[model samples]
Target chain A: MNNSQDLPLKNDIAARFLPLIIGLMVYVGTLCFVFTLFILSATHLWENQLRTQITLEVPASPGASSAPLQAQVLQVLSKTPGIQQASAVPKKEVETLLQSLLGTTLPVDLQFLPVLIEVSLNGREPIDIPMLEARLKIISPQIQLIDHRPWQVQVSSLINASVVLASTLTFLVLLTALVTTTFATRTSLLIHRQVVEVLHLIGATNEYIAKQFQVHALKQGLIASAIGAAFAFLTFIGIAALLEKAGLPSTSLSSFSIQAFCVFALSPFVTGGFMMLSARLTVMRGLRP
Target chain B: MSDFIAQFVGVGHQYKKGAEIFKGATFNIEPGSFHFLTGPSGSGKSSLLKMLYLGLKPTWGSIRLFGEDPLTMKPSLLPLLRQQVGVVFQEFKLLDHLKVIDNVSLPLRVRGIEAKRSYRDARELLNWVGLGDSLQAYPATLSGGQQQRVAIARAVITRPQLLLADEPTGNVDDDMAIKLLHLFEELNKMGTAIVIATHNQRLLERSPYPHLTIRRGTIIRTPKRSKP
Candidate 1:
């Protein structure tokens, strides 16, 4: 009999906290959705910028060696404030990448592959590629300074599109939360209407009733958010793995840094708080004449 | 611990100018005194009960309970005072969602009684009301007489000093009404003040105690208490 009596306590907990839990889960899920898109787009933009700094090509002529030309370009690059480190890439390494893309055997001579020099920059100021090209031409007319702004602009635009999309999704998620919270609170109040009346008749203050709802909503929100976060993380990891297998650009989805993850986790608490506020307002309004 | 359980002086109530429900109603229910309020339909029997239970304030004049004017009673203290007064509705307003035992035990629970003790008393009262086998049944599943029994059980479970019942036996058969009357008499013997509102002449004829009759929002026969 005693055990059975405690069962109602459990029921009370469930009834009070369930909506909060659901709210939290939805909040965390929305955050993860936005974060995943942001990470993929941001990393893609960063990688694209890294790839477009320079392009090199070598002639089939036996005398066409880039070693001396690379040395001269390095001298000019060292003096440039924005230039970080510049070094020539070995021909064999470039050949290997081509082989992976183009096949093991080729009709072309190995000398035709480019001796590429990789440039690292401070990214401080926009590179004056034309002026640098004129200076580089004085050392070796074959030397060219590549600005990479066209491809950078393209990648940046893609990043901007991603941001806009994520922001739109975030807005939709917030609106959904607001609607759900309002409806859930309203439904709960309706269900407990008589109990509310009884309490009022017996002299329970509005603040007391509001406190009960607040506690229950917060509890539900936190539990639901935790579940939602876990589910979103699992989905993110699963998608990242599948993409990796398909040879697409794959970064660690689980690599969501502490600060980012904290933001994601906090989303549920915010939702619960909103729900609590809505419930209090609804109850107060209903109690009024 | 107040000298007066309830007091109303010059109380009047009306609904939208149809007719005054109660006009210049003045009365006092002394501590531990039983009262029976009787009247024909629309004579404000229920309305007077409402004022006593704090459900409605008199349209005119002052009303007090527990020796304090209700209008000035702090809202926070209202629940504590109400917990001491229990009411049974004419329709047997039992919560249909709860089991009979649960419904009877509600007052105790609301008063912060531990479930273990409250349920023990609830089970005993259910048995006393001849509802021993139906403890787990919901109000909706019970017969009209059974539901009234459940309501009475709930009303008295808290051992309220004042118990107000409106038309408690109106829905029950004559035999069951007599049985419920004995139940109320037993509670009254135990020092709980009981007020039952009903139109049953046969039942009223059997009781030796005095009762007040209302007509046109006025008390025609005021019950006089014998001096202790």
Candidate 2:
């Protein structure tokens, strides 16, 4: 609020702690970048669950025939209450999905891939997998049911761990920022010792000196945070472009809601508040009589 | 509650890991009076002054400032009292990073005084001290006398009720030292209490004020002088 004086607030701080600030910005930026990725992946996994709940496979032994079994499985799925749609995925589609994991060139011909029937369910009712499997067995003795719960659990766990890891990294970044601000504040105080003592002599209160530091650091940290957030956004766009070109799953890391966007916008503000607190505490403690 | 601004009774102090420095020292500084504290090196003059400034507590006995006991004063309230007293240290202690004007204006700035007004007043004081042209110069580039003058300007800028100078003229020549002394005297004339600690006999001889002489850890005597 005191504007009687103009401080080269950003310029002076950048000059004094250029490397540290840059490093902080880059570290936060990278975390934000990865956070976006995790959010997108989590959303994709949720979307996948909403779209496909079950997979039915049929074996192809010497005398086995999948065409009749596929028809029977589709007929059973259509009668189920929660079942919305059922469709047979041709052999080639399955082979293509396996190609990524097995190799570009699979060992056998494309027709050799197992016949699969994808089942999508609707309405909020949880599917009874055991009953469905039992009813599905009456259609074909060779039918195998994959409810996708196990895979969903695995994906959810991975997403949860990723989120927890990102949150932990963000916490560590804040701690580092506090430590960094403390050191800078101490150095600044030592450099201004005479000024401080002179102010003390002039009857200037300790709170007044501490305010200057707090305000100055708040500005510094906000600027660094803006730079970091900007970098994060740009990196997100670059990664999105890379994934698009690679023809990978079209997952989106963009802000999903106002709240999500606000959280991103507030990153710098939170960082600034932390730096202000650390600097103020450091200055007062150093000047304590 | 009386008119006395400061009172020290049976005060004693010592540096850690060192012998007792001051022993049962006693003094009183009235609301608006100029006094000089003189002592040789190792005579504990700085230690005694530190006690007066509340920078160090007396090892024994009681001291009072502004009618309040310093021994029991809360840390939160000490700054309120300290801000009413100005200090000029022996080494000048000017911050090297700030320009001369900024250095001179620091006390006012620290007091949360408006910077424009503080700077305006600081420039005037610097002009008064004959260092107006050095306003933008850093302390390291200025002569020792100029730095001391800046220090003096900073000390008086706040218009504190009590001004303490510790060998302020130690780094200046005879003429500059006397000029600095006169500045302190001028502030004293305006009813700001002044205390100057120095070993310079010339300044003592030139000024006409009561003097406290210290030897070892105690005040040897107090002398009254003819009016300046």
Candidate 3:
């Protein structure tokens, strides 16, 4: 049923080595893809949470409780045409967040914590940031406006860099697999030169002989790719678990992105096809008298 | 595929022109004739066969196989033409990994015939060659004589229009050698054109087929005998 195994050179060193290298490439390729998805998911969530609001931080000053400054800023913001609504974050919430970050709030410095205000914009008006800054500065020179634009730019750049790196690695993995198949196919051709000669002598067309090698390559490619795929899948699960333990937002390695699932699913078939093509070409070239 | 299986005109061959291995050689075999090609060691017997099989183009002459110029034939067309020809190697070029039946069935398999479906023909041929019981055996496990028989079985299994063999019986005993010759005889009777290259002089006397002796890349035809 499977005729490629009937080929005498099937047990050659290169033949066995092909699957191992292909499997490793798939493993690394899957990791690169997974990391890219993780970045993408985190970036999307961060963008949604940060998109509509602007924040202002008011530092504590000597002999001045910032409650009055915060109320004045909010009153001024309410009068501004572009401001939808302005609200001051309670001091208790800020301290709770700082305690979680700094791991123990110093009792003495608790009252000295900065006052934070959130400003939501009405989409109908384009609020000028510098004008808002000058208006806020008139109330208190210590107020700092934190525009979300720079953060968005930085996040976009990071996401773009990661996407490009993942794509480059994917390209490299395919190239490596192709080179491995080509080299292995050539070696098999040379190893079985006499058998090939006999086949030729007996009236086998170059295509027929090439078909034999192609079938062999396809089988090998599929088998090796499956092994690689299984290993990659398991590694993703293990890495996801590790990431969860490290207190990071773990990627849904368990989350089936239909796109990623389809790509990984077709990888073995693509590998087999590549092997068949490369084998056909290599045999055709070798058969040239 | 054609009335004439092979034809050569001024067909001389050399790896390089002017430093010929053999030169200006011409020969032709009819559709169903059986012939022996005999010459000493290092003679051009193998080279001549190579040209006949389209393995090598003549350096400065013409070669026609199955009514097509081998030199001008499209590279893609060679396989179709080759399928009509069969060859048995002196080295017994059986794929050692394959079982005896598989080896014998390769010619048909290469042509896209289902190997399992063609088992009957392979079985019959192997049985006729005294290898019926060894169908499941590998070539490495077979003796030189057995390996040679497998090679012969493979060559003729396709019922090729032309069968070319190089020292097919070289490793066999004289009794087995005669038996092998008779197998070729049977194929020849079936209208398969056959040319056997051999160094065994006993076969030259044992049969009445024409001998196309090659001494220096040229055919020296022996006096004819009856085709009994």
Candidate 4:
């Protein structure tokens, strides 16, 4: 006949509020999920950049020239297995980096600055850090072998904590969405109890009544989640723009991977499907005699 | 098919608060029969009609509709039996949000019938009830008599095997009541069993159907008098 809904759900107060609540929850969840994705990508990029690189610091000697010790360290590194390249960091570049930190003034004599060396490994085999330290000590007892592994490990721990926090937040947001759907559906059933009873008396099955609620939930859920995801993507673009305006390198932001895009694309459908399921179950239980 | 459209054997009904409405009441509704269910208020007239339409189940004893025990039938299959039995509630339980035509065609729509066909049949029935122009109007906007007619149209839209009406003509005028009774008569002639529960003495005298009267929590059947 008219093909209109048997229940007047559109007029329900719950219907008006459900979409807004679901949209806000989806926004929070999408942000959390994207944050986790960004953290994971950044950690992966850092690991790849730091995996095969190490830095060496040669202290200045009072009675000997540090240039000779730096040259000896480079010679030793070149002869070692798995050592791809070795070179000293320019003293002037180090001095400029220090000036940026210490107000553009040389606090002490330039000769007192330690000689710094950059080392690259082939990455085919793991370097023996303790053995390298011993070898460097033979060259000069004041030499320091500073591998990047410890720093990377600390960064990894911090990133892992952030990912866990984001994931937990996303889970709680979704749970809240489900609870909201359930409560809204139940309230709708209560409000439309008489209409529902009329439908039941008119040869309508429970499944028929449930189908109405689920379809409403699905439509509302999809539109709300789409809006939420769109806002989240816009926020991402805004953050990227802000970073660029602040003179930060574009590479500092995590690039969107295919996985992240898929997550964003499927979020509406997933949320809608979940809401439909929740509404169906809540209506079924509420209609139970 | 069973000769009786409905059979109530040793049936009893009681409220949850332990108030027994009726006990050991037995009745059989044959196919294509029209009977008036009469009693004073609070005599379980509505309850009896409700049990016939599968809206309420007997607290004890057996009820067989369309040759199947409803109490023992699977809950999911109850709608199938309910579909075969149409009920017009005294309250005219129409959906307030739906337009008059939509409310009338709800039974057909619930059966998964095509919208065009169901709406056409609903429109024709509404025209017959003299509310053709009120198709788009909601139930809340209609008078009590018009709402009752809409309820009647909805009940008989499917041409069910058995029809149960509770005070079907209580809100309508004498003329409209007679017209509505004629509609039910036409349905009964088409092999539909009809049960009307009412206290209207004039309406009862107007028709020559047998009576199922309730007195002291028991049913007494008064067969139709033979024409002289």
Find the candidate with the highest DockQ and give its number: 4
lDDT of 4 by residue, A18-64 (tens): 88989999888987898798778767877976888898989987767
Tens-place lDDT digits, model 4, residues B139-219: 999999999999999999999999999999999999999999999999999999999999888889878899999887889
Q: Candidate 2, which CAPRI tier?
A: acceptable
- What TM-score does each of the candidates earn? 0.76, 0.78, 0.83, 0.89
lDDT of 3 at B210: 86
Query: What pairs collide in candidate 3?
Result: A203-B82, A205-B79
Model 4 error, position B182 (Å): 2.3
In model 1, where do residues sit more than 4 Å from their true spots? A1-62, A101-114, A122-134, A149-154, A184-238, A249-281, B1-3, B67-81, B171-193, B200-212, B220-228
After aligning candidate 1 to the native by TM-score, how far in Å is the CA of B88 from where it should be? 0.3
The parts of candidate 3 lying over 4 Å away from their true place are A1-4, A58-92, A102-115, A120-127, A135-143, A249-277, B1-3, B15-21, B39-43, B173-178, B199-208, B215-217, B220-224
TM-score of chain B of 1: 0.93
User: Which pairs clash in the backbone of model 2?
Assistant: A201-B86, A203-B83
lDDT of 2 by residue, A1-289 (tens): 1233222233344237733573465447455545655576556767577445788887665455667767777788888878878888877777778887789865866444557878888856677778988997886677898876676777767876877777677767677778878888887778667656655655667787788778888877778777776666566557666866887455343433343345557777877888899989998899786
Best by lDDT: 4
Q: How well does chain A score by TM in each candidate?
A: 0.74, 0.71, 0.79, 0.83
Grade the docking of candidate 4: medium
DockQ, structure candidate 1? 0.24
Query: What order do you get sorting by DockQ, best first?
Result: 4, 3, 2, 1
